[model samples]
Target: MGDWLRLTYFNGSLWRRFLIDYLFGIVVNNICAVVVAFVILPGDPFFHCWVFSMCIGSLVMWMADGCRILIWQGGRPSLPGLLGIFVVTIPVGYFGGSYLAAKLLALPVEAVLNRQIEHASPLLIMILIVCVFFAWFNWSQSELSELRAKAETEKAHMAAVERQAMQAQLQLLQAQIEPHMLFNTLANLQGLIALDAPRAQYMLDKLIHYLRASLSSSRAETTTLAHEFELMHAYLELMSVRMGARLTYSLTLPPELERFAIPPMLLQPLVENAIKHGLESKIEGGRVEVVAKRDDKRLKISVADDGLGLETGNGVHYPNHGTGLGVANVRERLRALHGDAASLTLEPNTPQGAIATLTLPYEP
Candidate 1:
């Protein structure tokens, strides 16, 4: 409650604002006092005019700032409101300050008025000077407020433009992934058709099922872990038909994490990489295991395969040693989406083959 009153309601400390107002009041009143001393009261002492001007200016500044804080909540008031404040403040400040100044100087209030009237009437001249100063102050404040509002609008526009550009890049990367998987599968299917007819027909059926599941997921930005695991099962089954006994796979998805959201096809490329790069070229192909688990505040997923290890039959990695198209695509997408909070790393799996691990912050 104290914070609300002192900070939130006033948009800052009220005492600090009061000090600033009073400081400005002193400067303005000094200028007015000098003008009155020279032009209106040439014979009277300058010190007397200075005292009276200070008292009146301080009172007027206090009243004006108080009204602004209470009614407009520290925001700029309308022109009518600004004029009304001056209308009310001038009379009250003049009468109150006259009385106060006279008491301070040890004289009757009537004596101060009589002396002012003896010269060219300093009261009317002081009022004119104050009006001009305040009018300029309010105009400058209005322009500053407009400039601030324009800057905020431009900042929002730039953020929206940046968001749109990032989305477009994500879509373009996803577009590259779909065709890469499709062409590779089709090439394998063509080879199988000439070597084995019945097996090729079975593979075609599996491909139909795989495509149905994958086509929808490929178009989406995010999917549940359950759907992703299900898609992986279909894909592995299709690949198994082509590789015969050479390909073996397992998918482990915890029930608690089934509904968790991940970018669509985020795991598919990793699984494809494990099989194509780690196992396919070897005479005795090995197993591919895809596991998902939560670790502290992060999600950890690993695609491990026991096959020919990092080096293929030719001693060089398939597609480009462990950082192939699939790895590069996944890495780039992860970086774009999560910046430094997410990561993808390749390491040698225990005993044999390779492991691709993805780590990202877990959000429930």
Candidate 2:
């Protein structure tokens, strides 16, 4: 109720509407108020005297408040709503009743005429201004409600877009890891069979264990740091069987980082990239060193291999490099999971091989 009234005096530019609506209601009311006085004045002072009194009073108030109707129906008040506001009560009740009122009170027609001439005063003008402010109050509240509804609709739309974007990123990350891991494990198994059948069987078992973990975690971006390491350990053992005495690897993790959370299969890609492109291409074979540590609020991991390093691996696609899938998949996953909070980088190790390093926020 209060809100509708406030909206009437809105937009300083629409003052004309306010004035017109107000004048219409009061003009109609005064016409009726006169009829009332005419009938009750005993036909002595007839319509002449009746019109003189309330005609001005009704007009003043009608002009003051008719804008109230426009506000009630929202900023753009309908013609019908405006018409209804004044028509419903003025002509049928107040104006017609004024004549009846005079007789009931025993006031002569002359007395009513004198009343109108002196009625409007300084205080009445002040009262009229107060009423205009009251109407403006109701209009403002209604506009706020409309604005709130619009904002909520926009928020819902944006949330939907964000959800779809994240899902697409996760899918891309998962796809990159699978085939890359499969080919690397196959290469390791092939090398093992030529030397020792029994050891090759053990290598196959570790391969299966690591792949199972990867597949199991495919649907999730997050996995425990410990689970990720366990996968890495199994894969490194498979490589050990194939490399003979010419190749070796090590996994080192800080005590405090043991329970931190990270994306699944993140380190596997870098290690595989190091082995296939960084070390296997070299004449002397190599040592792949894997390290994980927490520095302040971030988790850092590095895979370094002593072999002919980065120059041989440049521009080689992940799917083509046998195990390059790990690098590409982890990269995509990092961007998706943390925006720019995590990154994977590659550079040549101190003197001999390539080093791939990953930095990610430490989530306890």
Candidate 3:
């Protein structure tokens, strides 16, 4: 449809445009006046034709230039400026085009050709042209203004819709994590009660504290770097109790990088994944390490563990989806939020094990 409109509106192939201007628009309109002149007075055909062309074509020129100046000079000017230019420019176009027409057509003189008395003054017709142009110009301006305002309104509405959708999705992710985490903690506490009643009670208290802290922070979509790291530590303590020190860990964080902002629970899933996939498969023991550092314009966090890494079957590195839940969720969240400014990469650790590293924009 757009292509068709362009083809239709811009169809005047050079010479066709010239013909429309001089022959169709200019010549045809004057021919009517020329016919009128012939009926009024019966002498001097040459004089009548020349007078008719000059008087009529001048008005055409006025309308053409007036439209251009009003619509095309970047923007329309004030009423006074427009009226000033219009009044002065119309007469100039009238006389100038008349002079050119006479010279080109080999008329003997460029002056008004007839001695006929004025039936209507040319000035009155000029005023009528101004009134017509103003009517058209005002209507066009009003339409353009409405279109621009509507476009802005639509743009703002779209932005608000996008923001609401984002917030809802973030809340949903948090909601999913909370119940899953609570169930896991309960499982750990139940096993502890069968073995050591005192330790089970301690674990219950810690679990309660963790839930309390989570409830306080639940309303916020983002948290301070220090708070997220603290949450990571608490989750690891529960995992440590469940695994019986089979998954020893280390956290090496630089001191000054603890004030940045990041999405809550963003790191917990990645850490959980490292333990679930990389450490749980091993029989003897392994360690998962959390390393955090601040680069010039980014915050880098890594979760690494020593155990079976990316699963290999039939010589293909196929991920174990049963244990890859947290890793997949973190990757999706990072991409949806930060675009290309953030990155999550999973690769082999030094000798054996999987390492997941996240590089995020450090918002202070």
Candidate 4:
């Protein structure tokens, strides 16, 4: 009952809404009083006739408005349904109001009915005009409301579709990236087995651990920066086993920023590219630093290495070797997820070697 009342009254305020209807009734009554005074009851005392017209007109308008509300509660009406309602309710309201007004005015019911019959044509025309206007008003309002609701529903559905597409694309990219890294690691293990059996065994163990964690995370759409860093840490450890003392790496992440979410497998490619093009080429090899920091509302992550820089003109460098497939994949994923709000850049590290930096919005 409460819910129905709330729906029936504007803004869920029944008394306030009723007051508005009362005000509307007053306005309509005044208009009817003017018409009655100048045309229908010209010979009657102006004040008395005006008062009588107010009583009848106000009652009729109120009842008509109530009937309109009731009809609309059942949903938008058909044209025939609307016409039927107006036909039944309007005349009923008119006759009931007129009978009551005649009694209050100390006039005979026959006298009032006779006067109304004499002015029947003009009165009928006026009633027809009022009915047409109100009917058109109701119809237009219902159509506009329906259009707005349809638009909102479509907007929500489109948003859901876009999200699904993004997840599917991310999964496809991850699938490609996983095999590339796995093949490269296996190749390195094959070479190390012949040169250093004990080191190869250690690298195999690390590879197993890395694969278990990475494979699980890759199945997910996103992971925290801390988890991605852990995967990278395992990969670097595997590399260390292969390179011995020649390769060194560091990973730094603030405790507060660790919870920020990023696409899974996002950072590992940058680390791999650094090792393949930067440290591996240097005879003595060098250090790689993976650092993540907060930059206002954004996150800044960089993979920096101290090795043979871009000056070496290494063809193996990203976008240069097979069009930097791995790097390009990373950039494409970032663009899809964040649009223009995220970016990946490669530049020379301060002293030597390449630095790959990624900047993206920090979503918690």
Prediction RMSDs, each to the true structure: 6.8, 11.8, 11.8, 4.8
Q: Estimate, for each residue in 196-275, the C-alpha lDDT of model 3 and write its tens digit.
A: 99888878877876676666566687887777778778777767766776879888777787777788888888877777
Pitting candidate 2 against candidate 4, the one with the higher lDDT is 4
lDDT of 4 by residue, 183-246 (tens): 9999999999999898889999999999988876889988888899999999999899888898
Report lDDT (CA) for all predictions: 0.82, 0.63, 0.66, 0.79
Write the number of the candidate with greater lDDT, choosing between 1 and 3: 1
Error (Å) of candidate 3 at residue 321 is 6.5
Model 2 RMSD in Å is: 11.8
Output the number of the TM-score-best candidate.
Answer: 4
Q: Rank the candidates by lDDT, best first.
A: 1, 4, 3, 2
Assess candidate 2 and give its lDDT.
0.63
Q: Which residue ranges in model 1 land beyond 4 Å of their true spot?
A: 1-144, 194-198, 312-319
What digit string (tens of lDDT, one per residue) describes model 2 on residues 149-258? 68988888898898788877677676666676687678767876887789889888877777786666656756777778888887777776666676787888877777
Q: After superposition, how far is residue 159 of candidate 4 from its true place, in Å?
A: 3.2
CA deviation > 4 Å runs, candidate 2: 1-139, 187-196, 311-325, 362-364
Which 10-residue span in candidate 1 carries the lowest summed lDDT? 116-125
lDDT of 1 by residue, 172-233 (tens): 88788778988988899899889998988898899899889987877777889999999999
Mark the 10 consecutive residues where model 3 has the least summed lDDT.
Answer: 110-119
Superposed by TM-score, candidate 2 places the C-alpha of residue 24 at a distance from the truth, in angstroms, of 31
